[model samples]
Each structure stands twice: as C-alpha cells, then as structure tokens.
Target: MSDMPATPLLDTVDTPADLRTLKPAELRQLADELRQETISAVGSTGGHLGSGLGVVELTVAIHYVFNTPDDKLVWDVGHQCYPHKILTGRRSRIRTLRQGGGLSGFTKRSESEYDPFGAAHSSTSISAALGFAIANKLSDKPGKGIAVIGDGSMSAGMAYEAMNNAEAAGNRLVVILNDNDMSIAPPVGGLSAYLARMVSSSEYLGLREFAKKTIRKLSKRAHNAAAKAEEYARGMATGGTLFEELGFYYVGPIDGHNLEHLIPVLENVRDSEHGPILVHVVTKKGKGYAPAEAAADKYHGVQKFDVITGAQDKAPPGPPSYQNVFGETLAKLAETDARIVAITAAMPSGTGVDKFAQKHPERAFDVGIAEQHAVTFAAGLAAQGMRPFCAIYSTFLQRAYDQVVHDVAIQNLPVRFAIDRAGLVGADGATHAGSFDVTYLATLPNFVVMAAADEAELAHMTYTAAEHDSGPIAVRYPRGNGTGVPLPAVPQKLEIGKGRVVREGKTVAILSLGTRLGEALKAADALEAKGLSTTVADLRFAKPLDEALIRRLLTTHEVAVSVEEGAIGGLGAHVLTLASDEGLIDAGLKLRTMRLPDTFQDQDSPQKQYDEAGLNAEHIVDTVLKALRWNEASATGGGARA
Candidate 1:
C-alpha cells in the first residue's frame, strides 16, 4: 500500500462518463496518473504490464472522446485492458487480478457493463465489434462499435473477413489498428498527425462528399478517376492503401502516445459520416515504463516485482518446464531424423518450438496467429514425407479443429500434434484453460490421443508420436514445470494403447490420466491407510482406452474410479462407454468417474482450482468410500443402491 503511486487526477475519474467531463488540456495529466496507477497495480499483482503501459494514452483518448458504456469498445486479446479497467471503475480491485475469486487478467462480459464483449482470443475484436455495429444500425440506436486491434492480430484472415463485410455497418464502425510491433508506415510526426486530424475532420469529409457528387454529375469514369487519384494521394502520404482497399476510409499513422494528437483524431472519427473507418495509430509496446521499454517481451507478462526496480519474483529453481523439456527432446531427436520439423502459430517460445528453431531454423516455422494454416501446413509436410510437429496451445487449437479433422484425420496424415497447456491453466481462467482437448480429440476417428503424467512421460510420448507413421497422433501436457521425475536419457517409444500400473493393489482401482497421476497416487496412499488396498494406473492413451488393462482393473477391484484432469467426456466417458459395450457394468460393478465439474472455472491457483472442481486426493477418497458403502449396502439388501 505504501508503494502505490500518487494518482490525484485518476482519483477524480471513476468511469468514462467522469473522464468525458475533463478538458482536453487536463486529459494529459489524467493519462499520466492513470499510467502510474496501472504500473503500481500490476507491480503488486504481476500480470500484463507492458501492453497496458503502451495503451495508457490511447485508453485516455478513447474514453475521453467516446461515450464508452453506450458506445461499445471491444479490445482484441484484452491483455492491454488493465489501464482501461482502472479508468472504468475497477481500480479498487486492480491488485486482485489473476488471483482466486478476483478480477480476471482478460475482460469478461459478466464482470462489467463497460466491457461490451469479453475477449481473450486474438483477431475476434473486429468481428465482435461489427456484430454490435450492425445490431445498433438495425435497431436505429445512437451507438458506435469501436474495435481496437493490434497489427499482429491482423495476420489472421478473420480480421480481413470482418473488414470485407464492414461496409454494411456504415459510419457506425470504427477500427483502431494498434500498431505496436510492425511499423506499418513512417514514424508519426507533426506532419502525419496534422494529416490524420485534417482527413478525419468533418470539413474535409464534407468537401470530399461534395466533390464526389459533382464528379458523379459528369461521367462515371471521371468520378472513378477522381476518387482513385484522391485515394492514391492520401495513400502515398499516410500509407493506408491496404485498408482503403478493404472498404474503410483509412486515416492516420498517428502517434498513439501523444494525447494531443490522439484525442482530436478520435473525436473527428467519432463525428465523421464515414461508413467504416480505419485509424492506424503506432505505439511502443512499453512507452512510459523504462524497464518494460527496454525488454518488452520479458515484462509483457510479469510476476510480482519491486516498484522501484523491475525485478520479477522468480520461482525456486527445480526441474525444467514441460515445454522446454519437449523442445529439447524434439531438437535432440531431430538431429538423427532429418524429416523432423516443427511449427507454431505465433507462440514460438511459449510452445517451446523456439528451442527447436534455435537448433534447426530452416525446419522450424512460426506462421503468426494462423492456427488453421499451421495444422494444414503440417499436414502438407507430412504428406511430403516430412515429420512436421504442429506445436500449439490446446485453447488456440480449437480454432483449427476443422483443419484437424478434414486435413489430417480424414486423410490419415501423420502430423504430430504437440498440445501444450492441456489442462486447467491458473490465472488465465476458463478462456485460456485447455480443458476440452481430450474430449474433443479422443472422439475423432484415426486420432491417437496421449496424455503425459510427467515430464519423463512427455519425452517418451514425444518420441512415440515422432515414430508413429500409422495415423495422426497427439501428445498433450500441462502448463507449468514437470513433477521433478528424472527425464529419460534415451526416450522410449511407448506402445499405442498400453497403460502402465504405477502402484499395485487389489480392493480399489484408480485409473489416472495426464498430470493428475500424482493426486491419484496420494489418494491411493490415503485409501490404503483406511484399510483399503488401492491400485493406481497411469492410462497414457485416452482414445484407444487400454481395454484389457481397464477391464482387468474393473473386474478385479471392488470399486473402480477414473481420475483425469479434463471434462466429463474424456477418460471417464470412454471407460464408461467401453464398460457398457462389454457389459462390464451389468455385474454390479461399482464405477465412479472423477473429472472437472461442468462449469467454466474462474482464475485461481492450480491447486485451489483442482480442489474446487472436486478432483483432488480428498475428493477421490470420498468418492471411493461413498461407492464402497453403496456396494456394501446393495449386497446386504438393507439399503438401496445409490
């Protein structure tokens, strides 16, 4: 609390309505205070710091210019929304971000009315904002849909698709392209700022409209030539020919950090009569903060750090991260196998593909934010006799599911899918949680689904997937570091459908999948202490369903419980379906399945999330005990079966 920054101007404004009351000259101080408040808040909470720092002036300019709650403003990928959140009545709980039962790192529709649409995914803001614009246009309402998208997000085809259809929205759609990474034009200066303000001004637009009518009164070819010459002149000056071609009246390459330049341009765009408008505002990733400006990526997503010094809190050194383990293993394996290659959809370092790229830059490819293309590209490589591993986060992979099915599974291509973040992700909440990959991928035909219980198992599964040319094989792992198990020096190629029993017992059988194997073993220990002999089996493959191993465990044990860190339709559903098909459940078999609850979990610590979902050791013990009691009651005929 003592380290919190002084924000006198920010304290006077709670919402955009309050922000709109300030004079144009006072807004610069308000933006400065807002930036300080954002840095201080994120310093304690440790979330996206650099992106929010970059957008402080822009956030102030937008809220000061527009009626925000009424005029829907959608942020692409929502990482830079902390400053916006502070400006829009969430500063009190700003320090509670990414914690249990607190504010989310990304925007949520349920959180506030100011956030018109919730977004954590990339390239969806334009589409969502267009929907709002068209709906308002249809209802004859006085609201505009403003989409703030990044240049990196523009790499996806969806943004262009939305732009192509944006002509119908008329003047109600305003797209602010936040160009922080790629400098789309020459640096913003006095001339460029003046051009942006002049072009967006109503006087210039009115004169242009009159000229268009006058030219149309002559010949159609003359009108067309006049428009082309005018558009090309502006295109050469401001560098927005591409956006002009997409049916938007392109404006700017203005300074995003300069409130003097940004406010007037935004105010002009709001008052203009254009159907769809695109404003290109260039900014640095970390504009005001010196530490973040120096190293943008390191501070982009940060940990709790000192306010005076930007030194993030580091976790105690232990085993390597699961991603790094996979990357190193793949790189090592690729040395012997020339066909091995790697692909990632913009997240090279996040997915560990950067490690592979470092070893073999020619083979490793970062295809930007195009997951659909990544999957299909890997499929093509596989068809051409190259072992292409499409490494992507499980949440992002949902975008390319059609490609996974049509391009890979239907063709039976051997494209190896290295699914990262394959379980409940902490802090990022349900939006980034990889909760459905097992359920989704395991159900598909010609797909081999494997969940690694530890980093050692991940290495084996990685090698296994590399060697398997039979069909499309996938290996999924969690977000954090491995469970400290010693990685194999020489990785083994595991059998496709065989599961290994980690702990042996007779009375209770706990079938485990993914990283929840540790909890399953702990549950076995607790069950054994309670006079129950428990068996824990790490069922690696979720698809093929280790029928023989599962059948033996189900028949031999008094109670069989399936434990997996996935949704209802994953390992438990498969095992249940197999039991029903083989008539294993008809013989009074007491079967129980432990999985994540049927709800989207909020941001929390991983341990608390698992406990809240009732998938922890104590929950597993309770489930086994409850089932055993029901079995005993059914056998005695004293109580009815539960």
Candidate 2:
C-alpha cells in the first residue's frame, strides 16, 4: 500500500475504452502516470519490471488507437504485459501478480479477453496473431490481429515462419516490433521517424498494398530484382531491410517512448487496410525510472524493490543458487576437460553458462533465442568429438524436442543437457514448469535422464555426464538456492544404472528421485515414529533406472513407494514397469507411486505445489501407510491390518 504511486491520470483509465477517450495530447501524462503505477505495482509484487517500464508509451498507444478485444493485441513473451494489464482493467489486481492465487506474470487467455492468446515463451505472438487475423478474415469479423514482439524475440525462426505466411492474412495482421533492447538502439527523433510516419500512414498504405499485389504477379527474375531493390530502398528509408525480404510491409525505427510518434504511427497502422504490416518501434528496456535505466539489464525480472531507490529486497543469506553452482562446477570441470563446451539459447546468464563463458568464451556459444539451433549445434559439436553441454531451462527445452530426438538421441551423440529449472518453478506456474522433461526425454531410445536430489548430487551427475560419452544425457535441477550440502573436493563419476540407499529398513521402502529425496527422508522419519521401518533410496537416474536396487527393495520390503518431482509417466511409471517386468511384485508386495496430478497446477509457492501434487513428506507418509496396510492384508491372504 505504501509503495503504490499516486496515479491520477492512470486512475482514469479502467480499460482501453477509457484510454481511448482522452485526447492524443493527454496520453503523454497518462503514459507517465501508467509508468509510475507500473513501477509501483512491480516494486511491491517483484515480477517483470524493466520490460514493462520500457513499453509504457507503447502500451498506452496501442490500446488508445486500436479497439481491443475486437482487435487482437497479442504480446510476445508477455514480459511487458504489466503496463498493458494495468490499462486493460487488471490494475486493481496488479500488485497481486506472481503470488499464490494471484494474477499470472505472463499473459493468460483465461485471465482476460485482452489476452487473446496465452504466452510465456517468446516468438509465438506473430504466429498466434496470424491465426487470429485469418480466423477474423474467414468469419467476416470486424477486427484485425496485432502482435507486439520484442527485438530479442526476432532471433527465433518462428517469427520468420509467421512472416513468410503474412501475405495471406492480407491487410488484417499488424506486428509491432518492440525493439526495446536491440544491440543497436535506433537513433531517436530524426528524419527516420518522420519518414516512418509518412510511409506507414493511411494515405500511403493503399499504394503500398497495390504494389505488393503487383509485385506478386511479376516473373521470378523480375520479382527478385524488384524485391531486392524494394528491400534496400526501404532499409535506407525506414531501416527494415530484413523484414522487407520476409514479405512484411516494414515501417519504423520510430522512438517508442515518444508518445506523439508512437500514437500517430500506431493509429495509421490500425486504420489502414494494408495486411501483414510490421512497425518497428525502438524503446529503452528501462525508461523513466532512473535506477532501472542505469542498470545493464534494465531490471528485466526482479524481486520486490524500493520504489525510490530501486533496491530490490534480497533473499535471506543461504547457500549459492543451483545455477551458480552449475556454472562454477562446469567452469572447474572445463579446466581439465578441453573437450567440454557450453551452449545456451539466448540465456547464458539464466542457464549459468555465462560463468563458463567468462572462463572459456571461445568454447561457449550463446545462440540467441534459437533453442532448435542450440540443440543441433551442440549435436554437431558432440559428433566432432567435443563434449557440448546444452545448458537450457527444462521448459525451454520443449522447443528443441525434434532436434533432441533426431539429431542427438537418434544418432546416439553424446550431447550433455544441463537442464535448469527442473520442476514446479514458483510464480511462473505450469507454463514454465519443468515437469514433463523426464517423461519426454526418458522415453527417447538413446537418451539418459537424471534429476538432482540436492546440490551435491547435481555436481556428481555433472561429472558423470562429462565422463560418459555414450549418448544424450540430461541432468535436471530445480530453481532457487541449494540445500547447503558440503561439496566433495572434486566431483565424482558414479556408476550408471545404480541408486544409493540413504537408510535401510525392512517394512516399507521409499524410493525417491530428484529434489523429492529430501521430503522422502522426512517421510521416513515420520514412518519410523509409527514403528514402521522405512528405507529411503535416491534413484538418481530416471532413465536406465537401477533395476537391481528396485528388485532388492521390492523383494525385501513388504511395501515399496516411488516418489518424484515430475508428472505421471516419469520416474514412478518407469519403476512400476521395471517391478512388474521383474516378477518381484508377485509376492503380495504393495506398491504405490506419487507424482504431480493430471491437471495443470497454477502459480503458488514450490512447497504448496508439491503438497498439492502429493509429492511432499506428509503425502509420502500417507501413501506408505496405506500401502503398508494393503501389504499386510495381502500377505495374510484375507483380513485387513486393523
């Protein structure tokens, strides 16, 4: 409440309809108020700040000019949606963002009609926008599709893939290239801005559309020459060489912060009947806020912060984050292994590859927003005898699945996958959850999948993957700080297809995978209090599972339970298959599996998510208790335990 800014102008804006009422001149004040409100809201909630700050004017301009809901305004990645959210009647709940039972950090279609298509991942906006545009065209609906994509997102092949089919949408699709943080931020307020408005205005668009249709009718040779000439001419005139070559009517390099420039150009684009137009609007990543502007990353994502000083609230002092440990360990490992190389898809810092990059910049590759490329590039490196660790988030790895299967797993190439953010990532919810990586990767024939029980286990798995050059190996670890375990002086390579037993007991055995092992230990203590002997084993490898350990535990123990921080058909499913195949379960052994529920879990604390998923200690104890009773009844050949 204290951090909430006094947004008098912004208070007047309840929706895009309300925003549309104000005169064009009044929008500057409104944008300033919106910027302050956005900063205040994010400062209190601690979500995406810098990206929203950068798009204040652009958000104000888009909603003001276009008739939203009717006009599909799709935000690419949704990182900058805070400002848009505030303008679109979600301001009251703005500060509740990323909290338990709160608004999502990214755009969710269910949240509001304003969010036409849900987006958390980058580069899908243009494609979604085209879908909306074509659907509208077919339905004879009275609206167009507008996608606001950032420059960083332009690196993905999907954006170009959308642009290639843009002509078919015809005067219905509008893409606003939000070039906020490009390497070369376009020069502000010059002849380029004036020319952009002139070229993109309603009066000029009719002629431009006619020329586009006329060009399509040309011969291949004539079309190539004409297209090349048009590309260079537009590039010189409006700074859109690449987009023009991709069949988009390019217009911009306009200053996004300049509301006067932004509003008019957007108004022209909205009113025009020209299809598949891309307006490149250049803006700063963190504008207006002094501290954000000064920071290198413009406070892209942040913890709760002081609005005045922009000083973010720091977490309590604890062990280093799993990311930092991964980076440091990889850097250390690279010192001895010259064959080790690192690759990330536009997320060197997020994946902790930046640490390795600092030590071995020559060997590290930050393939920008191109996960498909990153996977294949790593596969190529592995094929040439170099060990390439494709450090990517588990959620992002979904984009390169085909490449992982065809290039790495199918070929049996030894490309190492250092998957960060392995399980229920807080705030980001199901969209960013790393729950399916085990099921997806482990199911592949030559793929070896592993999840870290803790920070120390993560190191051992890292060493193991580097040492083994057999096939594609993926080691998954969760987000946030580690469990402060003492690290070995040097990482050790463990025997594959083997699991270590944490505690030995005869009555009930709890088999654990990934971070769930800690909870399994807690459940063991609880089970012990009830006079039940529980053995806890950390099943480190999800694929090539420790079959001997599984058979031993199931045969010796009356009841066996498998726990994991993954969806169904993951570690537990694999264990069940092995147990059934081995015929060890024929002796009336009660078996149970614990995993995340079938439904998609929403945004909540990691602990709450695990609790809801029945992967926590209490659930584990409950599961074991139920299994124990069932085992007793089955063993006696008739009556219940009680």
Candidate 3:
C-alpha cells in the first residue's frame, strides 16, 4: 500500500461519536478524503463503486449530524454503504471486501453497531426505519429514526406502501429520498416522471410554506376551507400531491452534493417533532469520478482498475457468458416471431436483455425492482396471445414465487422464464446465489423446470420454452462463461422430458442435472482408472423425471447416485421420492444423492466453492466408491478393469 498523507480530521475519527468533535468546515475536508478512500478501495476490490461515490457527502453529513449507534440510520440497498463502512472502523480490512473470510459487500447488522438494518434487495429501508421508529416511541427512548433511500429504489410499490403507512401512523420518522434520477439504469415509470416534474417546479417551495403559514391563522370554522386550499395549491405546485395526500410533511428537491444546503435541511428535520417527513435530495450517480460520471451504470459494480487512467482490467477471453448467449439467442428467435416479448425487473444490461431491448423496443419492458409485477405482467401478456419471456436472476425470482404459482401456473399461461445466475454466484455471496429455484419451482403444479448443461443446451432449452404451448416453462443457467461449444446457426427444440445417456456402465450410474454434468463426466473418467466403470446421464427436466431411463439404469446398474448444483429439497430429494414410491429401495439397490449440504456456503471463487461442497469430480468418485462398499475390491483390481 502507498503511504499517502491521510487527512487529520479523518484520522482522528474512528466512530460516529468521534465525528462530533470536528467543525463543519473540517467535515467537508473529511468527506473529500472519504470519497478518495472509497474510490481507491473499490478500485482494488472491484465491488460496488458508483453508489458509494454518489453518497459520500450525504453519508458524511448524516453521521456528522445524527447521534448514531443510538439514533438508528438505515440504508436501503446497502450498495452505497462503503463510505459508511470505512468511517465506521472497517477501513483496514477494506481490501478483502466481497472475498472469502472478509468484509461483506453490503451492510451487515452483525458486522458493526453502525448498521441498524441490512439490505441487498431494493426498496426495504422505509419499512425497516418505520419499525425502529415505532419501537423507539413505544419504548419511550425518543431518538431520531432515519431511512436513506435512493430515487431508483423509490420506484418500487413497497416504498409507496411504507410511505402511506408511515404518513397515516403520523410518527416521528425521517425518510431521506436520495434522488439521483437513476437506479442501476435510468429509472422508468410514472413515479420517476412525477418526481422529475416536482424537481423542476419553480414555485413548489414558496407555495408550500405560504400554505402552512396561512393554514395556522385560520379559525376552526374555516380550517376545512384552509385545508382544501392547501391541498389544491400543493397539487398545482409540487407534483408529489400523491405523497402529501398520504399524510407526510414533504420537503425537498434540494441539492444533495452541496453540504451547505443538505446539513441545515437534515438538521431541521431532525429537530422537528413532527409527523413523518420526506426530504428529497437530488444527487448525481458517480459524482466525483470523471469516468464514473460519464457511465454510471458500468461503474455501479466494476472489476479492479487503474486509478489515474480509469481503465478496468481486461477479463480473459473464453466462451461467452450464459447471460450473453441467452440474450443473443432470444433476439434471434424474436426476429422471426413477432409474438415473443421480453421483460426484466430493473435489470436490462445485467441480465443481458439490453440487446433485445434495443432491437425490439416496443416489445421489451423494464419493470423497476418489482418482481411480482413482472411475473404477473408476463402472465397478462401471455393471456393476450403474446409469448412473454421473463428474464430474471434466480435469487431475485424468489421474490415473485406467489405470482408464479397464482398468475402463471394456475392460469396455465405460456410464460417462458429465462432464469440467469442459477447456481453458486461468486463475489456477491449467499444473498445473491441462485441455489433454490430448482426445488421451489419444481413443486408447482403446472411448471416445468429444466437446467442447461452448457451454452448449446441453453439455446435449445430457450427454443423449447418459446415453442412449448403448455403451461409455464423455466430454463436455468449458471453465472459465468460456457464450455467453449460451437454455436448452431439455427435453434432447435428438444424432447420435453427425455434425458441423454453420456456414458454406459453396469457397476454404477450417475444421474446428473444441469451444470454438474461436466463434473460427473470427469468423475466417471477418474473412476475408470480404479477399475470402476461408471455411467453418466443428464436428466434435462427436473419436474418430469424420465422414469423409463431411470428404471432401466436401476435394473442394470448395482448402485445409483444423483447430483445437482442445488440444495437438499431439489433434484436429489425428487429422485428419492420416486425411488420410495416405486419400492426401488426394497429391491436391495444402493442409492446416494449429492447436493449442496444443508448449510449456507461462504463467499469464494466458483471453483473453490464447488470443491469445498464436495460437488467436484474427485469427491464424487470417492463418494460413489464409498457408497458401493467396493473400495477394497477396486483397490485390488478384482472388479471390472479399466
């Protein structure tokens, strides 16, 4: 590490309590230095960058003004908490962020006293802050409770729900609306346009104060008339008439980067013992860094890069990522079929649907952070004779489980779900892992679940889902690059419930699902060296198990093993259910299932994570040998020889 001169104000403050000793001018210097540290740290670690950079001044102002560690401060998405984390005494370990036994990428309540509520998904801060406010009021420990949320997160319906409830309850809560006019991408929807209108209104502030002063002077008989006038004036001046109607003391459209304006406004809200207040602070995403300011979305999360040149490290060339393949394949399919449409929940570029959105602008929809709405909306589109492809990450898809069951499956709509990031995701850790989709969706009545073995298979599955006129169909693919397979000029559909046998052997059989087929193949080769002939089968569809193929394998092979890149309640559990029903266990056949253990895997590289979970080839071979009790015979070479 380079020995750059640290700012004196920053060096003296280790906690929020220490921040009180610094003067307001000194805090400005501290904010600048903090921004520099955040830029450097994230540049080295390659994690959330733009959000943190945008919120640096606001973070400093909040910690400086609020009595933190007692007065609760909640950050909505927690992607912007790097500045908060650094100032709260985690700076020394900042280099290890999002790594295996180091600091978490988001705000963790267990990690420090400063983080009151933790969040990874968007639009949760207001509810959490309200909970704290109510608790504080009930407990009689009267302190300020604040929720700092971004304009991007504000698009979700849940934020409005929380605002409505908070206003109705009339509690002393402060909601700092950090309006940068962007989420991951430039925000969409009527709410965003409304906020923009309010931000642009010239007479909004002057009219609000005039109405409040005029309302106070009116007699009891004319109070109703005063209220009516105030409402009418507010509706005309500020476009947040919807929020005021919900009963909040609305304040802002202020300059968030200017500490002079932000501090006094925050202090006024903090001191006022009023009803719920919403302070709208307009900021710029990637405020200070020039490269980041030019492209906020690209810098939102970035790879390690050079500071001076602002050039990101080039990734090694390999097979295209599964997300890219899905996007390209879907675009090609949509060219021929005008009925096909794509939908994403606030992620156009991340899910690789940006290309499709560009080509088919009229058919593409970008619903902001509202997964439930996305699913139900797709169902509606399907009902109208349009083929809707709902592209979302697996973990995020969990948010819309009820919609999948009620809207899509129950109605028997042909909504094709392209589930990206369907396995262990590296860097982002457990909260973002795509581990539970196979189990969760497989149990739904009218749903068909399938996993891709490689890029080619993913294309085939996409083609299959688009053509299938049956109920909802899902095709899940992992996060990273494919297996370097050659592309097909035209896509073809696969048999719905059929599986292919890769290698045939009589001693043991491995029924692999999804991306684990490659590992099973490698294990089969390794076992052959020890005189253990192994069979490998790729079960394409998880919901409808290929009973004939499974029965054939059970009759021919002495022992069988099931493998998947998911948890206990997934493919392995389903196979066991079949075995129990068919009385296969009573016939003296040995069985073993290899799935992720019943514990949350920690943060690590994808390769290391697979090895640790015993899902790799060497461990699979060992597990199969141990299960068959043929270890000694295999060592002596008395069984089938290689």
Summarize candidate 1's per-residue lDDT along 255-287 as a digit string, tens digits. 999988998999999999876999999999878
lDDT (Cα, tens digit) per residue for candidate 2, span 1-642: 665678887888899999888988898899889998888888888898888899898888888888898999999999889999888889889989998888999999899999989999999999999999999899999889999999899999999999998889987999989887763448557676788888888777777667767988989788778767866987886677777777777888888888878777887887777657888888888899989889947498999998988899999999878888888899999999999999999888888999999999999999899999999999999999999999999999999999999999989999999999998998889889988899999899988888888999888999999988988899999999899898777999988878999999988899999988889999999877766878999989998999888888988888889988888899888988887887756767789998888988899888888878888899998887776553443434322354
lDDT: the better of candidates 1 and 2: 1
Cα RMSD of all models vs. native, in order, equals 2.3, 2.8, 4.4
Which pairs of residues collide in candidate 1? Answer: 170-275, 171-275
Report lDDT (CA) for all predictions.
0.92, 0.87, 0.83
| lDDT, candidate 3, at 420 | 90
Tell me the lDDT of model 3 at 18: 83
Highest lDDT among the candidates is held by which one?
A: 1
Question: Which parts of model 2 have CA positions greater than 4 angstroms off?
Answer: 183-185, 207-231, 630-640
Best by TM-score: 1
In candidate 1, what residue range of length 10 has the lowest lDDT sum? 632-641
lDDT of 3 by residue, 348-409 (tens): 88787887888889988999899999999999999999999999999999999999999998
TM-score of each model, paired residue for residue: 0.98, 0.96, 0.93
Superposition TM-score, candidate 3 onto the true structure: 0.93
